[model samples]
Target: MSSYYGRPVLKEPVWKVPDVPAYLYLGGMAGASSSMALLAGLTGRQRLARTGRLAAAVGATASVGALVHDLGRPMRFLNMLRVVKLTSPLSVGSWILAPFSGLAGAAAASDVTGLLPVPGRAAGVVAGVLAPAMTTYTAVLLADTAVPGWHEAYRELPFVFAGSAVASAGAVGMVSAPAESAPARRMAVSGSVLELAASRRMEGRLGLAAEAYRTGRAGMVLRAARAATAVGAGLALLAGRSRAAGIAAGACLTLGSIATRYGVFEAGRETARDPRYVVDPQRERLRERESAGRGEVH
Candidate 1:
């Protein structure tokens, strides 16, 4: 039999991006802001803590709203609550988000009321722990999809997001906190460093998918991220940091982080749409299957 050129391509889900991108942005902000609130409370920045908590609460609410609104049938969103499928990353994520969101709301509310009970301290601490995980886990959730760029870059995605979340939250803190606070500077610096490292790791570890991060719009966003992270962190480390510098850097990091997410997701859509990613891998599998079949027959 003769083989034909220009074979037909297979496709994955065709998602309307408006909601997913917004959801990703909101979720990251919410998680990061919550982390900031917890840290501010610990460091005795009452005003910062109070403002940060309100910020987190609003962000979190927006996130949940975005999530449901993204679903065409918003009413059916409640169906997700009834299931527990460990193998499904979205399912696992929904579970993780439920309690985390509740706790974040409680913490934010306590800050507003000026009655953060000693017992509630335990809740805030727990929420603080869950906050980072909430941000990190979304990377895992995106990667779990049968999307090439996302699935292949799995190992580095969580770290990338973690660093981005920190930077994003730190930026918000910079807006709210006084410039001289050592903790805020440290957090921003830490986030910037981690984000830069994680981006490098993504470029290094993922050979093909890394191309997504390196070219066109993706490249532009990543390039900006690198520059911002490096410069921001460097300035913070040197001369003991300044509010203006920190704000600028944080803005860059926040923007860069958001762009990265969109770029990654877009690349995955491209990967899923392209015949090469699906065909080549499947062809290899078929060859193996044929060889095994022949061997069994013999």
Candidate 2:
């Protein structure tokens, strides 16, 4: 409730809009697309598999470009690779991004050009194996930060991100291979459910921190995301091979995923700008601890 001159106790995030948000969205889409590609290939849906590979390749490449652009230098990103630290989310994320970009690109190239079929499938498989971590590591990266909204929602953030990733990939599949996209539709529906549910749970449990997510610009964007995702899922369920419906659903789902990422990023920024979000929580924790100690002594 109190602060030095009413200034924020924590530094606001320096990440720029569109760059960091785009990186998060594209990386998540690529990771889930790779997994979808691997599964589709194994099931003999070659067209769907190829579509997934292409989507994953493009998304990964764009994601890395956005990240590098945000960093202001390619070398900064490279520096993250100098040492692998399990305790560092940024380090782990860089490693994941680097290999994922290569593998996804190679897989897509081979599938498109019909060259090195064996190697292409192998690369796709490896990328698929790393996809889950790729999709959710960003959540860890955000949650590990000092930002109140993100850190407080750590318990459900990964699930929210994973669901968004899956839905994004599934949307790609729906748009690209509508006729053979039963699996994609299923993923879209299930992922939307998970994303919506986890988001609700996360906000509900955040207590004071939830204000950042429920007010201002962050609130509007997040509300839009929820609406789009819900509508997209409904459309996916009834698409039934209609190319128009599939495309519409895919577009909505993609928009929803993008909105979610930006909304979360902005929420963290909002929390960091308000000293109340920081000071109030710490004070409450101290009070609880003090009360517990007194009771134990008595």
TM-scores across all candidates? Answer: 0.83, 0.99
lDDT of 2: 0.95
Q: Quick one: best lDDT, which candidate? A: 2
Model 1 lDDT per residue over 46-161, tens place: 76676566666676777777778778776656678799998888888887677767777787776666676664566667777778877788899877777777887788888887
Q: Model 1, residue 183: what's the lDDT?
A: 59
Q: Could you say which candidate leads in TM-score?
A: 2
TM-score of 1: 0.83
Clashing pairs in 2: none
In terms of lDDT, model 1 sits at: 0.71
Assess each prediction's global lDDT (C-alpha) against the native: 0.71, 0.95
lDDT (10s digit) by residue, model 2, range 149-172: 999999999999999999999999
